[model samples]
Target: MLSPRAIAHKILLHIEQESGYPDRLLQSYLDRYDNLDPRDKGLITELVFGVLRWQGRLDSIISRFSSVKLKKINPVVRIILRTAIYQILFLDKIPARAAVNEAVKLARESQPDYVVRFVNAVLRRVSDNIESLKKVDKTNLTASGIAEIYSHPKWIVDAWVKELGTEETAELCRANNKTPPTSIRVNTLLTTSENLAEELRRAGIEVQPCKYAPDALEVKKGHFNLQRLEAYEKGLFQIQDEASQLVAHILTPRPEERILDACAGFGGKTSIFAQLMENSGEIMAVDLSPWKVATLEENLERLKIGIVGTLQTDVRKLNEMNIKPFDRIFLDAPCSGLGVLRRKPDIKWKRRPGDVYRLSLLQRDLLDSLASLLRVGGVLVYATCTLLNIENSEVIESFLQNHPEFCIEPISDTIPWMKVFARGPYFCSFPHRHGTDGFFAARLKRIK
Candidate 1:
């Protein structure tokens, strides 16, 4: 049996080499090491996510100790030190000596004896100065750039600095580094919220009802794999963010209304719409990739969704027959994913400043193509998992310029709880501000 640190090392290497998502990847790795106690499991998860979240800060510390530049260090050893130092600084329960010893053991797997010794020395240095590391002054944004130190791209920090002020930007960066809570959407079709709450209690799970969403629940304690829980396998609920759950309601599809969920990957919100319409509406879910749309189709079948019609086609182009116009539509446009950095930590490093401008261009093309399929006076809800102005408000502002028939509509009556929405009927959320994923959505009505 491999030690938990060795398993973590394997998982960390995969995260560095592959394009897989962290949650799924981490869960898969944990499935192999089933005997790990919940406490150890939690530690491994924290180390993995923390290293990804603060790679720059870890790298900066590594740079201070090693002759090699941060990236120039051996990938395996680098990840080991990162995992060790993360525990030393952030995790109070893991003793510094244990952290250093585990790191040395992990390094010995591939490196020679001398390389392991080097890792031990470097990590000891970090452990000795954990307090100073925690209190490092971040006042100078340029010299010791807070954004980079906090594992965020400098450009995003610049944008946040301009929009949220310097002090607020640093706070936002720090908040994003922390792991987001697990939010699950209860499947209303199978059971009511109250019934599911009772079911969760039966399973010995401590859960809290979502304040804003009637069907959402936040896991407070008792970390059980949701899949094995009878509530989940029986189609009782799904893990989805609160902000994402907002998208379906913002559209406010009526029973028997014709709607298209363009870019409906995995069908989480699409299933919500199916439930809301009480299986009485026609929903066409379109996505560019067949693989993603297929998963959605599978989910619809599993959840007994009768009203949803799945299709694999680009949202930028609709080629369905006898589909004149939809009463309501959602683009759920793909963008830089800046808003979801907490869940998708790699996105922060993967994204470039210019990606926003480029994605904004694609979003415009998608909006233009999809809006044409909406009937006059129809409601179109445009949404993204991105918080930047260029991708949200600015793009919507530009679109309204070209299409005068479409105008922003009041969303207060629709979503009463979300008071801090974007100006002019657009809904914008920040993780730090709304306790939800940073999201942006705009409601528009087409007037002929």
Candidate 2:
């Protein structure tokens, strides 16, 4: 069995070399070593995510200590130093000497003796100046300074500064770097939030009611495997962010209505639609990937929901099928995913400046295609877990400019309690402001 550091090294190397989500890759590796102790698993997770979260700052620090430029270093050696430096600077429990020793040992596996010695020299330098290097001047408001201090790409920092002043952007970056809370929505069909919270607490898991979403609970403290819990096996609740849970409330499908969950990824929101409709409505849950469709079917089955049907086809293809207009539609369109950085830090490194514009085009196409599928007077909620206006309001604005038949339905009037989260006609939640994943949702009504 690979040690936790070894496992982390492999996963981080894969992330650097390939195009895949860190969470998915980490889970696959952990599953292979299921015999690992829970503490070991936890450490593996911490090292992999911590290294990614602080990669930019780590590289900056490495540059200060290494004679070789960061780009010139061997890929594996770079990953080893990154993990060791992450543990040294971030993990208080880990001794700096142990971190440096483990890094040298990891380097010896594949690197030459010279490279191994190089790794030792750099980590030792980092340890020696650890206190001085750790001090990030918050007053340095330049984009590059904020980028290095917060470990975000400079382009992202610049964009955010333009949209939300520098101070707010810094706060947002700070929030994104921290660990996100584990929030779950109670499956009201099976049990109430109170009962589920009681059950979880009885299992020695401390949970508190979510401030906004009535059925959501934040796991304040717990160490047990959530999937192993009886409540989870029974599908009494789903692990969803409180911000995401609020999207279902925006849709608010009624009994016996026909709803279309466009771009439903494993039916996270589709299940909620079934619950709100009290299983009286028919939902055509569509996704582009066949595997995701299969998983959606399984998740619905686990939740004991039967009112929804799954389809595996590009959402744009749905127009070719002879389907009747629906009472409601929820298009959780794909975006750059900047909003959930705390949960998925790899996105900061993976996404580029142009990705937002590229995704906005697709969002527009999906919105236009789904608009024809909604009957006049029906509601369609377009949502994305991204903070970019290009993907959020700009797409909506361009659509409204072209599609005169549809008009923005103010979320404040539709869901008064959400007024605080609303920016005029749109509903948005900021990680820095609302303590939820950065989410944007716009309600539009098809009017003749």
Candidate 3:
């Protein structure tokens, strides 16, 4: 019978110190408390994600009122303050008195009397000056200022500003803070997008066709878990971003062709490729993690796809496996995952400035190793759910320079909405502009 705040505190503490994903941890808690009402569930979700999303700003405000530095504060006490301060600053339905009272109560339960007093004093001050704290003067926006105002790390804000310009970077940050739409791709093998949309509407789920991907449906309203839906169980659709759905189309895998999903993590794109090929092609799906390969195998079974063969092996060691060259190859290389921050807010805090450079080198090595596995004239679609130049364009440029046999290919004919996300010969989607995750994909063909 834990309160929503209590549940959020436990999840936050674990997220701060442990290795569990917030979404998975939250879902496990929700499932454990099956009798808990939707209101409590919603509150727990909001508190956990909101506190994490705005942790930087909350810490800044907390430091302003407390004599103690943030790092010096006990972790439990820190999360309690963060959760309370988040409600006061952001959640309008929550009264200031309730936020402060709950925080003090939680603090009293876990901390000493002095810590409770300190928590009460800081929160009361924050509550009294909440209006002033809400206002940020956007007229003079520096990179550091944007970071503080938007609750993103300064390095991320600075990098975005340098790459996307100040105005667009701010817009991107704003988009990242928004709760992204739950978009799913209709599994065209079993049902058409039109039919799936009709079925979802009949099931009382509000959905609409996405503009970017032909098969994507943007779910507007639904309380039911999508996995439990009749359509989902029947393999009518799979939860995927509109931008991600486009990568498989960009590769344009033909029926009966041999394809390789070199870094297939959970098989989102592999599943789509199976459907696009009408489950007729041979798709060798490889991943470094056995757990992910197992999950991909489960997905392939649920989707009733038979063309994909699962392999649990490192993508960089594909040549060692003695696999044959394929007509199509998909290298959805791992990067910083900056592009999907809206869905995974914790990434904004977990990633360091140097991690981007390190990930970029890994991406380059992946491309270099996997490129040789593509047959001459075969299409290799290199994709990442990241927008950074070092990870996207720079990696591709270096690869093309080192291997002159591959050339960038235009993707306009791959799908009808290519014009929506096409950047010359490459596919790029921004969260702010595309209403989807920031993604970069390049279609390269071997010319030798």
Candidate 4:
């Protein structure tokens, strides 16, 4: 029966100490405390995500207020300060006094008398100077300025500024800082989108038809567990982002086609492919992790999909499997996950500057290896939830230089509705512009 703030404190500590994903950890807590008030659950979610989203700015504020350096402070005490400061600065409904009081109380539980007083004094100072702390200079376009203002790493800001200019980079950072929508794809194999939307509304969840993807819905309102819904148990839909749903459509797998979902992690898009094919195709969903393969199989069963087979093998090792040429191949290669920051803000902190360059090389290798597995005239869609050019189009360019047999195929040619997402021959969706996760995909055809 921990209070919402206490639960948030624990979750944030786990994220800082164990590198746990906020969503999964929060969900686990909520699931265990099913009888907890929905509002309290919402607060817990808000505190954890808000604290992580604005960690950079929060740390800056801490440094300004505390005599002790930010790094020298105890980790637990730092989390207490962060949660209190987040609520004080961001939440209009929460009183600054209540935030400050709760932080002192939390600190007193484990900290010494001097430390508790120190926490109280720091929060009070922040509360008195709250206006100044909340005021952001949007006109500051310098890398360090944007990093501190938008709570992004300086290197990421530098990269975005170098590639996308200051204005768009600021917009991207703003979008990443905001909360992302909860989107799910209709399991057309089990129910129609219209019917599922109706069911969700009847059950008190407000949903809207997704703007681009024909089969996806955005949850406009609802705080309860989606997995507890009868529709979820019945497998009428699968939780997925609108942008991610578009990748399978870009691949456009046909009924009875032999498809290779290379680097398939948990099979969100693979399940959509099965639905589009009316559950008639053979989809070999491959991943390097055994846990992901097991999870994919479980999700496929829950979604009532029967056509996808799970394979626990790396894409680099697939050549030794003697697999026949496939009609379609989907390489949702791993990347820096920069585009999904809105949904997973921890990524902004977890990823290093070198990660983008390192992952781009892996993406290029995945594309090169999968190219030989696709039959002549077959299409292979390479996609990532990332905004960096070095990991997206540049990876494709590097692969094409060595593998002349494959050329970029316009995504719009296969799905004309996707033309709106097109950037040159590639499909690029931005969180700021598209209201979806930042995503990049390029469809390539084996020209023989």
Candidate 5:
């Protein structure tokens, strides 16, 4: 019986205090509160994600109005203020009075009378000055200004400014703030993209074929409960990004080839590999978490894909394992995950500048350990869902320096749509440019 604001506040509290992912936590709440109508569910999701996405800007506005430091304010009260402020500033459909009234109501339920008065005073002030409060000077392009304007952490803004330059970084930040379109890859093994698109349309879903990945479909409208759909039950598609689908295409696994998915978490690309090989190749999917390995196994069954074999082990130590050499090796190494900020806005707040350097080291170790597993003349596709130079190009450059036998392979010849994403020898996609998650991928071939 909890209101959407109440539910969002509870979820945000956990996300802030425990570093829990907002999507997972929100899904859990939706599942737990099965009685919540679709509208309430939508509101809960919007409030939680919206507040997290714009937390930096919201805090700036709060600092402008309140004497209290953001860190010193009670976490629950802070989230309440943010939710109200977001609606006031961004949501045109939501009347300012409704947003303020709801916050005051929620405040009364959780805090003392004085705290309720504080919430009322602050929200009323924000609502009254909402027009002026929304205007941020776009001409000021300082790192701190960019951070405030874009609602991204100062460190992330500064890093992007240095690597991507100010204008492009601002564009990236703006893209991250916008709601990302839902993209899914059709399981070509079960159905063709045309057939799947027709089926989804028949089911009242608006979908369009993705230009980059042949199998990708962009769902423009309609409910996306894939689990409840007959197509999903029959394993016709899996939710994946268009850019992510391109990673497997770069590998170009042939029938009956031996492949190693070195960092397969829940087997997104592993399943793609199976489909690419027409379910004839043997894919050894490995991940550090046993839970992920189990999930991958379940997905393999659900997709009716039998060629993939699962291994629960850290990819960094794969050199010590007695696994056989692979004709192709895929190292989807972990990075700062800055690229998918549109989907996971909380990461921008939680991630630190040092995390990128630490992850780059791990990425190097993964490549070095897994490179030996690739057969001479075989392919190795190094990829990350991040736009950072330290994690993408730098990692591959460092690996090539140490391993002379492996050389960068131009992705242009691998797929017909290469012109859309090929960045010299590397493949890169940006949210602002490609309308896909920002991703960087390199195809390397072993020469020795």
Candidate 6:
């Protein structure tokens, strides 16, 4: 029987060497490996995500004791320490001695003599200070909250500090570190939200209705193998957040009206738009990524949605389609994904704050590019899955100033959950406040 640590080491090594998402990799691992029981599967998940969440602090501990350079350590040894220390600190069930012993075994096999010795010394030292590491010192800036609780970039915290104030930013950081609730949108065309909830319940899954998104349901967390379920294969539901579902709703597509989902990579929102339009209106789903466009087509096929026309072309080069002015266009621009830190914890570590401004410029350009295709009096919903002011409201504000023909139409009480979030009639959702992924949207009408 392969120990859970061995499996975790392999997964972590893949994460470090290859460019793949931890979520997808973990899922694939669980699906492909047959020897794992539910308990072992749970252990592997805890070890992998725990190490990833506390990478910064784990490195600090290694640097404090190890004589060798941090960069020179073998990747295998590093992953061993990551798995061991992760158990020692976060997982209450894993006894400290077992973690150390297994780590030493891994180190000796994969690393040289010098590295193995150093890793042994480091893991022992970390075990001694494990209690101290777990202690919460609210006064210290590098305390557990910012270090372990948020699992976010220090620069992101600093940026949030400037924007959301110290206390509010701390709340935001805490919210991001938590395991996000699994919210899925019911395909209203196939079923109602209440019926879907009942179906999930009958299938031994607990689900609750989302307070915000009318068509969304919050599933019980730590679900195992949702893809294997007949419900998933039949496409009774889609995995999307409440806030994201709201974006398509905000677009408010009427039946028979032509729509363009510009920059619709993989078409999550586009599928929702098709459902809302009752499969009557035409939707041109365009993206720069040809691979993603192909994936989008497959997803549409899986959902049994036939109304969307998937096109693999950059909307920036608008000449690809000899298209007439559309009644509505949904611009779900790409941003730094700051608001979705809970779903993709690695994004916080990977992104620099400066990248937001660069993306803001691109978002503005994309808006202008797509706006040219909208007819006068047509509605255009500009949206982003980001919380940064630079990417959200600021980009829209800049676009409004540059384009005199477009006006920010006041969106008063379109969605009931949005009643409290009236930031000058612009819709913004935050994890801390709205219990949804961070999102921003504004309604604009082209005036003659």
lDDT of each: 0.82, 0.91, 0.89, 0.90, 0.88, 0.81
Best by TM-score: 4
Error of 5 at 164 (Å): 1.8
User: What is the C-alpha lDDT profile of model 5 across 1-448, one tens digit per residue?
Assistant: 8898899999998998898767778888888897888888888888988898899999888877876788888998999999999989988988999999999999999799998998898888888788898777899588888888889988888888998899988898989998888888899888998999999888888899887787899989876365567887788989888888888788989999999998899899999999989999799999998988998898888888999888888887778878788999998888899999998999988898889999999999889988889899999999999988899999989999999998998877666567678877789899998888988999999999
Best by lDDT: 2
TM-score of each: 0.95, 0.97, 0.97, 0.98, 0.97, 0.93
Measured by TM-score, how close is model 3 to the native structure? 0.97
List residue ranges in candidate 1 displaced over 4 A: 138-144, 319-322
Model 4, position 57, has a per-residue lDDT of 91
Model 3, poorest ten-residue lDDT window? 410-419
lDDT of each residue in 57-144, candidate 3, tens digit only: 9999999999899899999999999999999999999999999999999999878999999999999999999999988898768888
**What order do you get sorting by lDDT, best first?**
2, 4, 3, 5, 1, 6
Q: What is the lDDT of residue 131 in candidate 2?
A: 95
On a 0 to 1 TM-score scale, where does candidate 1 land against the true structure?
A: 0.95
Residue-wise C-alpha lDDT for candidate 4, range 22-139, written one tens digit per residue: 8989999999888998889989999999999999999999999999999999999999999999999999899999999888888888999999999999999999999988787777
Candidate 6 per-residue lDDT, tens place, 403-435, comes to: 999998755655555666556778878889988
- How accurate locally is residue 413 in candidate 5, as Cα lDDT from 0 to 100? 69
CA lDDT, candidate 1, residue 69 = 75
Off by over 4 Å in 4: none
Looking at model 2, residue 179 earns an lDDT score of: 81
Q: What is the lDDT of candidate 1?
A: 0.82
Error of 1 at 280 (Å): 0.9
Where does model 5 exceed 4 Å of error? 413-416
| Cα lDDT, model 4, residue 443 | 90
Instruction: Give lDDT tens digits, candidate 2, residues 155-274.
Output: 999999999988999999999988888898899899998899899999889999999998899999885357668889899989899999997789989989999999999799999999
